[model samples]
Target: MIIEIAAQGGFGGITAASLRKTIDVSDQPERMRQDLCDAFEPDQLARLASRPCTNCADRMTYRITVTEDRGTHSFTLREAQIPPEMLDLIDQM
Candidate 1:
């Protein structure tokens, strides 16, 4: 399955409509949400959702909450204020 969560203006902010493309989300949004989750436990998803606010300054924050039989998990991300040293990497995105 391939799910594409697009951002308007080519970057920043995420909305329900932005996630309008869920081709085959067998285990999606969850799997493709970010690369960091790869190192964490499934239950950790919920903790990420409770992090600091990402929607600062009219920017719409995005958070993913997953609920399983045992419990739930989450993840969130706002505009990438990548450090100057990481500017090159941000440009690629």
Candidate 2:
């Protein structure tokens, strides 16, 4: 599986090309791979993305896309909606 993340709209409301990250779970260690898969399960990610969010100016928004053998899923969510663990995963990628 492959995951792509693009971050936008922070304090500066700007997103450069460098803000994009791509993670190839297949290349990670066995444990890391398992953690990633568990953290980014399609059903869970979709649930988080679909939730309602209140006004949050200057907070970052992230567009996360996951591609698997079956197909792909994409979600755009406010930073506050993302779990802390997932946020760390994005950063480490």
How do all models score by TM-score?
Answer: 0.31, 0.87
Give the CA lDDT, 0 to 100, for residue 67 in model 2. 97
lDDT of 2 by residue, 22-69 (tens): 989999999889989988878889999888777756788888899999
Best by lDDT: 2
Candidate 1 segments exceeding 4 Å error: 1-17, 23-42, 63-93
Give each model's whole-structure lDDT.
0.36, 0.84
Cand. 1 TM to true fold: 0.31
Show pairs that collide, candidate 2. none
Question: How good is model 2 by TM-score?
Answer: 0.87
Task: Assess candidate 2 and give its lDDT.
Answer: 0.84
Top-TM-score candidate index: 2
lDDT of 2 at 31: 86
All models, RMSD in angstroms? 7.9, 2.1
